[model samples]
Each structure stands twice: as structure tokens, then as C-alpha cells.
Target: MAATPNIYGILAEFETPADAMHAAEKVRDTGFRKWDVFTPYPVHGMDKAMGLKNSKVGWFSFIGGVTGYTSGMVMIWWMNAVDYPIPIGGKPMFSPFGAFPPCYELTILLGAFGALFGMLFMNRLPRLHHPLLKHRRFALATHDRYFIVIETTDPKYSENETRKLLESVGSKRIELVEE
Candidate 1:
């Protein structure tokens, strides 16, 4: 008996951005969660067609910025007022105006870090390998072609049905990608 190959997904290639966008819409309508689209350039309205929501990176950045600002203020207060009282020129020991510069700088720094880390986490990036990377046709995605990959792990995936769906969407080429 022959061992069955591990199927990764179904890959559909499109001739143009419009075709790929339309295919994405159909896939989205079919309610497949484990799917993604690739294109040579950014496709306007692709997010909507894919039913994607706003990124969570902004929330991460906001939280980081708030934490940074608060920590900066607290650190300055601790050092100036609590740890050692330096009464210079009758100036207040702890002042918001004085802390604003360092607080603002920390806020920017932490916010940027949050955005970078958040993006990497959300994308599951730094991946060492992917089945699609080995596919010869997939490389064209960076050059001229657009491709849509519907993972077999998706709840709605049915080999026959998914292939038919791709055909209906006018895919130029369809292949079963294996792991």
C-alpha cells in the first residue's frame, strides 16, 4: 500500500488582480477561514473582499504608549521627589512639564516596539518554511501572477467542491499543494 501524501491546500492562480479579487470574494462568501491571497502589488479593496477586520496592532501600540508615559512619569517622581528631594531654584520637586519630554520620548519608543512585535505576532512570521514556498508557480506571485490558497484544514474544505469553486471563479490554473 502506498502512503497518502499530506495535502496542504488548494492553490488557484489568476491572470489579473481583478480575477484574484473576485475569487477571494467567492471564497469569503463560502466561509473558508484558512485561506489567503497573494499578489504582485497591493490590491485595493482586497481586505474587504477577504472579510478581514481592522488590525490589532493599534491597540498594542496604544497600550505600550500609555504604559511608557506612566512609567516615565512615575520614575521621574520617584527619583526627584521620593528618593532624593532636589530643591533647585525653588522649582517643584516633581512637575508634569519637566517630565513631559522624557515621557513623550518613551511613549514613542515603546509604541514603535509594540507595533513591530504586534505585527510579527499577528502574522505568525519568521516562519522557516511553508508548503507554498516550494511551489514553483507561487514564485510568480511576486512578479506578475496573483494566487489564492485555501487550506485543507479549513472547516468547509472538500477537495472536489473546492476545485469546482476555483473553476467557477475562473482560475487560470488550480493545483493541490502537498505538505
Candidate 2:
């Protein structure tokens, strides 16, 4: 017998955002974690349905901001006090008040960079292609369809059972996505 084809996942198409959201809740309750939902437009409460937690991007930004501020302050102090020992009209060479503007600017710059890079990293973006992109009907996802995909990598995934689950959850159409 020939070997079975490798598959990326099972794709279920829903007629409406509510149907997709409800199916997501079912999928979550069924304990299948390796899944994603795609919609033509944003759906409120979808994150809760997908069981996702708060993002760590903010933490990345905070760390970047702190590093920038510390580095800015240290560089200013080292240049003014340790390196040149500048004495300007009896003013302290390394006063923090004098360094606040540059420090704040650096903090904002690095924090913005952190947020941008962190978002891209977290989303695994810059991808050129995905298996789902080959699905003929998937192009409609940007117009009017909503899709839910459950990857075969999920521990709970079984072809027959996943198909049945999607059917029971009111999927209008279901198609297998090959890798």
C-alpha cells in the first residue's frame, strides 16, 4: 500500500463569525490546543475562546526601555565625569537632571523598537507561504468566510474524531490541508 500523505491540519469553514467563535469554544473545551481561527474581520472575545493568555510584548518593551535608560545615563556620566571631568560653571558633571532628556528619548526609541521586533517574533511573521495558503477556498477568508484549523500535531487530534467534532460544531464545510 502507498504511504498516507502528510497533512498540516483540518480546516473547517463557518458561515458567520458567531459560528466560528462557538466552534472555537468547543475546540478549546475539547482540549485541542494546536489550533487557530481565521476571520474576514476582527471578532471580539476570540482570544478568550482560543484560551490565549496576556501577551509578553509589554515585558519586552519594558526591558528595552530600562536598558536604554540605564545605558544613556551611564554613557552621559562616563563621558562627562569619568572621561573628561567637565566642570561647567560649578555644575555637577554627571547630574541626572541634566541627563533626563537624552535618557527619556533613548527609552522611547528602544521601547518602540522592542515592541516592533517583539510583535514580529511572537507572531512568527515574515513567512512567505503556509500550507493553508494552497487551499482554494481559503482566499475567501479575507472577504466573507471564517476558518478554524486544528493541526495534526495536537495530542488529541485524530482524523476521524476531528472531522466528526467539526461536523458536530456546525461547520458548513471541512477540508483536509496537506503539508
Candidate that scores best on TM-score: 1
Q: How do the residues 49-132 of candidate 2 rate in per-residue lDDT, one tens digit apiece?
A: 988889999988999899999999999999999998979999988899999999999999999988999999998988999999
Specify the highest-lDDT model's number: 1
Tens digits of per-residue lDDT, candidate 1, 15-101, equal: 999999999999999999999999988999999999999989999899889989999999999999999989999999999999999
**Local distance difference test, each candidate:** 0.95, 0.94
For model 1, what is the alpha-carbon lDDT of residue 100? 97
- The predictions' CA RMSDs to the true structure, in order, are 1.1, 1.6
lDDT of 1 at 115: 91
Instruction: Output the TM-score of candidate 1.
Output: 0.96
